[model samples]
Target: MSTMGNSTNIFWQESPIGKLERQKLLNQKGCVVWITGLSGSGKSTLACSLSRELYTRGKLSYILDGDNLRHGLNKDLGFKADDRTENIRRVGEVAKLFADTGLICIASLISPYRKDRDACRAMLPDANFIEARLLEDGLHEHVRQEIQKAFTSLHVLERLKIFSPYLDLISLHSRSYIQPGFTGIDDPYEPPLNCEIEIQQKDGDCPTPGAMAGEVVSYLEEKGWDVYQQASGSNM
Candidate 1:
């Protein structure tokens, strides 16, 4: 692995303005929200909804839809498995660039292959990769647990104090996000355990997206990002 990487090594030019400076100027941290689900599962909707929520709160964000990119950046790629993998690989790089600019990049892609998705996550620094699952048709409790167990292993790897990496992850799901052979179902899904947050769509006794948005906003605020917060009457 080391030899292969060395063989492919190329010069990495440093940007005059680094990620930290960019984030500081933008008053926000940049990261990628990789939204994956079956077609018509509302991944795009969730991305748009989350983007709007972020926008109102004074944060900048962008969306890279899988279908839309085929018209341009990924035009050369086809639907063959290999082509699809390459397509997603390019998208990952683009998403990382957007995140580096202090803009939250919402990448709504089918991204079916677990290995491919994991590879995309690996492209960025730890805690920068967030995988959001849209559960429209629903999931069995046991399966959810299994997926969570799989995800838990990946997240808790930053225990060492020295050179340890922090992770920021969350999962969201609901109805209208299901399909035959869809991820988390016929196909395998790796859900996150110990996620920072989770939003359930139309849960029997759950909160609405608006409520979840508030929760997310609160999280961002707590993290010191410049998010739009409602004016409070507190005089501290």
Candidate 2:
């Protein structure tokens, strides 16, 4: 027994069946595919596509869409920075559990903060945490230009400073012009520095949903997470 967070004298319960057994049963290695990006960046679309692609290949997969989870698991949480952090933490734990059951857990969220995402990555083995960043071409550049314009205005800076204590800086900045607390607008979205996969636009256009899903599936296959080996049966 030990103290953990608000709970006291809590203990971790061990399971009779281990992850290896579950993987054997499912014939695939357990892993988390975390897809992160700004709103309207097609994160959910890619997640659904990827899951469908895996299903067609006979691999088990599950999707944890951010908006969908808000209806239940994170219903109590708000959009404040701290609430967002807690929301991501809860989803990460759930995703980890699904992965342990030999399912490819796909988590699609805005997940603006880098530290929060990194904390989730630390929850699993290094290899099991696959960070996939989805973005549109020129999106980052456009955001950067907007941020620069915001910072250049002395009036905007003063207003932001006045509100900074009560609100997130990104929220304050964005609320002055566009949607408040919008990721990639006022809230900074930290892209993964060393992600396992990056799905982005090509030749000034985004690829079809199937092509995007195929890209992720190809990566999984290359990394050998698409299948598991069967035990020898001499009796047969």
Candidate 3:
């Protein structure tokens, strides 16, 4: 049991068509790869790349990007601590639905707070949802990409320096009144201690987001949830 929903006096309506039935039809077991980190952490890149890789391997996957959601479903929400928690909660519900229906739902968001991220984790059963943390070192390619796409020809080093103090403060505290919901500013972003798969793009590893995506796919395969396994008539 991952979590208990908020509603009371309401019962869950079990679907006549279960997850196994859907998975067998789709040739894949559903799961949510919740990618959590700060902005410019390469979550968007990872999500898209992973989705494409899975698709190429004859698997069904979808990316639910944070910015894309804000333009529609979460548009009404502001950047307050409570609003941020609610945002993740809503995304978790959607991801749960996607996972139940045999789809790999990749949720990329700057889910700053540890509690919020944990709540999302609780929404799915063990192994169904994985927390993928993208650390600063893994974002070297992200820095390069963002710089190239910058409208003002901003320097990457300068930007990192600007954001460093805030992150340092966040490392010391869980919440701050000044930055409100901004992680590493006024809000804290608790790094995952034991994530299922930690893709490190460090000094000696594959440096591209695509490579990290492949690593995630490989990790999933090792966990006995390979999407391709279904096609071979093997049970996960």
- Most accurate candidate by lDDT: 2
Q: Which stretches of candidate 1 lie over 4 Å from their true place?
A: 1-10, 138-199, 203-236
In candidate 1, list every pair of residues with a backbone clash: 57-228, 127-167, 135-174, 136-174, 136-175, 136-176, 136-177
- Superposed model 2: Cα runs more than 4 Å off: 138-179, 227-236
Q: Model 2's lDDT to the true fold?
A: 0.82
Clashes of each: 7, 1, 0
What TM-score, over all chains together, does every model reach? 0.65, 0.79, 0.75
The top-ranked prediction according to TM-score is 2
Candidate 2 Cα deviation (angstroms), residue 233:
12
Which 10-residue window in model 2 sums to the lowest lDDT?
227-236
Return the clash pairs for model 3, or none.
Answer: none
Q: By TM-score, is 1 or 2 better?
A: 2
Could you arrange the candidates by lDDT from highest to lowest? Answer: 2, 3, 1
The predicted structure with the larger TM-score, 1 or 3, is 3
TM-score, cand. 2: 0.79
Alpha-carbon shift of residue 111 in model 2 (angstroms): 0.5
* Candidate 2 residue pairs in backbone clash: 170-186
